[model samples]
Every structure is written in structure tokens, then in C-alpha cells.
Target: MPDPAGQPPPSSHTLWRAFVPRWAYMPLSGEGAARFGGRWNPVGQPTIYAARELSTAWAEYNQGFVQHPALIAQLRLDAARLVDLTDPAELDARRIDPSIHACEWRDAMDRGKVPETHRLRKRLMGEGADGVIYPSFMSPGGTCVALWRWNAPGALRLTVVDPDHRLPKTQASWV
Candidate 1:
């Protein structure tokens, strides 16, 4: 997929295999943390099973953010016609406000489209590490995915998706 202006597209392996990195930075504002009940913490270190769930959740979230508008519109337009089929009571109960849903979807899409930038070298080093041993860093636009999963009855899983594949893997590895 092509990267949006001011946003980097995820690497193939990252898209298919690992957690996105931007998630690591979130609960960006205190509001986000409050939305999730409080300060967020990972349940455990990254693992293969957690990674798989992360990928699935991220895929679902991204698809929803991207397609919610169209899907909501189509569902609303068809709701009247579908009302008579099979369970009428069930259909009525399941009905959603098209306009409201559309608005929400649009808002989500807008938020998703916003770009995130990071100063890698500066972040890795200290704020005043100019001319230090660290290499020069370049700022780039990037997109990220956040996935939350239920690892067990009471355990939660969190993963971040880095579109640019900027995270370090095993020693001596490169993305």
C-alpha cells in the first residue's frame, strides 16, 4: 500500500507479523488513559501468540476506521428493506441511526488519517545530545496501529504497530 502524505506505509513483515509501534506512545493524552480506565500497562513481554492477536485486532481496527463510513451508509440504506425479512423485532432492535453512525465513522477516519512524527535519535539519546555519539536523526511521517486483546480471563494484551518498521528486533537485525 502507498503511504499517505506525511505518513509512512508499514513494511510487509510489519503489516503481517508484528505489533505496530505507535501503540507504545499512546494513551497520548490523559484523556486516552482515562478512556481505558487508567494508566496503561502491558500484561507481558511480546510473544508469538500475543503478536498474532495483535495483528488480527489491528487489522479489524484499521478496516473499521477506513470502511465505517461506507458500511454505515450502506447498512442504513438497506435497513428499511431488510426490516421485513425474517425477524422483524430483532431487526428493529438492532437498528442504528445512520446519520449518527456516519458522523462517528467520519470522525474516526479523520483521526486515523492524522500523521505522527518522531525524532528517533533524539529520543534514543538525551534531549541535549547534539554532536554526541548518536547518528543524525531524520523526522518522518508515520502511521501506527494499536491492538488490545484478552490474553486470558483477566489478562489483557497490548501491541503497537509501526508502519515504518522502526523498532529493533533481535541483536544484529534490521527491518
Candidate 2:
């Protein structure tokens, strides 16, 4: 909510991500979404989707269905050039509707069509957005962020809360 007037996200904030155990070690990597695609990114685009709240991250990970093993991590998100979909003014300036958040991406992909959300994300990225913050679909009133790039010129910084180095050092643990 720091930039309702079309600026970056807060100077800093906390976000959460619940990752599958197989990919837990690489919590910051967007490879999963890159390979599988997501509501905000096309199959070849990388994205790290996280929640503004812990419970919302859990809900987003399970997607209102069966619960499974997960490695939830707290992330400290730093200054970001983001697009706030939660703000009507921002969306209006982009000529995007709020309904883009609830677009049925899977169904559109099933029909071999591009979902509007993906298109919107693509357009935003082209316009230099590091990510997008929007209302969560599974958790009402909660917010979520879908980050597309990091370590780039004018990109955001996202780090995991593993101060003790307890997590795996390499992805081989999952391999």
C-alpha cells in the first residue's frame, strides 16, 4: 500500500512462500513457475509467487484442496518496482480490470488460449515491473505478490529467513 499513486512497493516488507519439499532449498528460484507456468506468468517466464501473510501462503500452496508436506519460508522483500493490482487507480492507468486477478488461467490454457492475466503480466514486465501485488484468490482479503525478476537492473531483492543455514546447501538433497 506504499505506492497507490503508481510507485514501487514498500521500501521493504515480509512475504511468505510455502514450497514443495523437493524444491524447498531453492526457495528464491522461479524455476518451478518457469517450467510449469502460473496465473501471472507464461510457461517460459520465471515468477516467484508469495503471500503477504503466512496463512495466505499456506492456503495458496494447498489451493483449498488436499494438504501436503511443505517447507514454508519467510522472505524479506526489499524495494521493488512493482505494479499494485489492488489499487484501482493503478489498474485504471494500465487499462487493466481488477478481474484479471480471478481470470481462469488453467481453463484458458486448456483451450489453448492465452489467459488475460498472463498477457497483463507480460505487458507489465515489458513496462519494467519487477513484480505484481494483488489480492489472493484462495484467501479472501489477503494479498499476494508474483515477482518476475531479481538481481537485474532496477529489480527487487528477496531473501529467505534462513539465518542459521539450516536448509540444504545444494539442490542435490531433493535429487
Candidate 3:
């Protein structure tokens, strides 16, 4: 759920990757730089730096950065966002592949009834936030539909993996 301001809760422990142009390093200012000092000493003009966590001061570092060889990084667990799945009903009405809502699909599979164009397979939930929304192993991009095969006996625990909004298959066009 979003905070009172309708924004994802502020993160304290999530790791962040900031791609700093060689020219921008000296000017970069944040608690991490103040505490750890500039680790990227402007070697090749462009480099990725792993900031300690999300901070209002690091307002410029919201985008994902590509992996780099020389940069060291760590993820902050304190600021991790919990998956918001208070309503799985919404997904059920939308993204599930219409061809397989019943046991017939499974029965067909058992009988070697595979199709030529697209394969119909069992649904799977991912390990983290993407799982809450996508819940299918067949596709990595994610679908709005989920077949919740199992539930924890009393409570639910979800981990946050990415902050960006991933569109469900229903609302997104996939080629």
C-alpha cells in the first residue's frame, strides 16, 4: 500500500545504483558520500556507484543502473517495500489465460495434449514483489493474473524486489 501521501514508503535499506558521469562525481552529495567518501575517483569518465540506500538527498539517483565491474554494491533491507496484495481478486478477473482456468488443462497435459502455437502450463508465483503481481513463471515480464496454489496457514509475508511499476499483461501489450 502507498503511504499517506500515496507514495511508496520511503526506503532505508534498499540498495541503489547511481550511474555517475565522470564529471558529476565531485558534485555528488549525499549521506553516503559524506560517510563513505567518494569511492569512484573519476577514472573513465562514466561509472556506476552503489549508493547505500534511498534518500531524499539522493533525489537524482532513482533510475536503475547497469552493472559495472569496478563498483561495489549492497542492498539495504531496512527500507524494503512489502508486496501489496490485499486484493488478488482484481488480478483473477483480469490476466489469467482464458484457455486454462480448470483442471482440464492439467488433465490434457497428463495425456500429452500439447498445442502447437502456445504451451499451456501451470502458473507459478515468483519469490518476491514480481510474484505478487505477475505470479507466473512462464513469463518473466509478468501477468496480472495469478493462480494462488497455496497460502501460508495464518499470515502472508512478501518481499520487495523492484520499486518501479510493472504493468500486468492485461494492460500491457506483449509481442
Best by lDDT: 2
Off by over 4 Å in 2: 1-10
How well does candidate 2 match the true structure in TM-score terms? 0.89
lDDT of 3 by residue, 44-81 (tens): 22222333333311333432244332221232333333
What's the lDDT for residue 164 in model 1?
Answer: 77
Distance from true position, residue 53, model 3, in Å?
12
Cα-based lDDT for every prediction: 0.23, 0.84, 0.29
lDDT by residue (111-140, candidate 2, tens digit) is 899999888877777776778889988899
Q: How big is the RMSD of model 1?
A: 20.9
| Candidate topping TM-score | 2
Off by over 4 Å in 3: 16-68, 73-175
Q: Which regions in candidate 1 have their CA more than 4 angstroms from the true location?
A: 1-19, 22-91, 104-149, 154-175
Which should have the higher lDDT, number 1 or number 2? Answer: 2
Poorest 10 consecutive residues by lDDT, candidate 3: 116-125
TM-score of each: 0.18, 0.89, 0.19
